[model samples]
Target: MSEDKSNRVVSGRVVSNAMDRTISVLVERRVKHPLYGKFLRRSMKLHAHDADNACNPGDWVRVEQCRPLSKTKCWRLVEIVEKAR
Candidate 1:
């Protein structure tokens, strides 16, 4: 089988790195409210596999969809977009 390079990628901030080889990322998106038509922020917490455990809380990272590595990990860290300031 061929690996799909077009997997979905999401950019978010690392929220937690307590778990071994795993990190929690908080992805946020702005969407317009259907009724009020006002843009509102929506965020989701996703578990991602960080093989090197190099990510830290508050760091921006890009995660790509991948085969499930664990119960809650279906995404893997692609790269560290920005280091924590």
Candidate 2:
């Protein structure tokens, strides 16, 4: 039997690419307040592995979850959705 496991995918903008073969992504999502019905924006900084270092700041990219590559990097870059001007 061929079994496939799907990994989590996240789309975000590249915030930083200072580290070698690594990039930081800023994922933002809107959530409603628990008490009030106010929509608030929340952002998270995620570390992903950029094998070819093809990502740049402000570049929209998609990352898929994978085995821990590093202490903070458990996600790997999949494709560049949009490039920054």
Candidate 3:
């Protein structure tokens, strides 16, 4: 990988790519309920930099942490894991 290995990496689905060189990703994680011993789903929207604008809505992608490129963008697209069908 060209990027630093220490950076955090996560996978998510592209939610939007309307902005130039940027894509919004929807990341979902399962969290265990502290009291009930049940699993709950939580999700967040992340703004990831996609230099090629190659990601489309519903595409699965991997993003890694990097120096903040903007006020809310600190993650960058690493690769497209799956394309929308």
Displacement of the residue 53 alpha carbon in candidate 2, Å: 0.8
| Model 2 agreement with the true structure over 10-57: per-residue lDDT tens digits | 999999999999999999999999999999999999999999999999
Per-model TM-score versus the true fold: 0.92, 0.93, 0.92
Best by TM-score: 2
lDDT of each: 0.97, 0.96, 0.95
- Per-residue lDDT over 1-85 for candidate 3, one digit per residue giving the tens place of the 0 to 100 score: 5974698899999999999999999999999999999999999999999999899999999999899999999999999999999
In candidate 1, which residue ranges exceed 4 Å CA deviation?
A: 1-5
Q: In what order do the candidates fall by lDDT, top score first? A: 1, 2, 3
Ten residues in sequence with the least summed lDDT for candidate 2: 1-10
What lDDT score goes with residue 19 in model 3? 95
lDDT of 1 by residue, 6-83 (tens): 899999999999999999999999999999999999999999999999999999999999999988899999999999
So what's the TM-score on candidate 1?
0.92
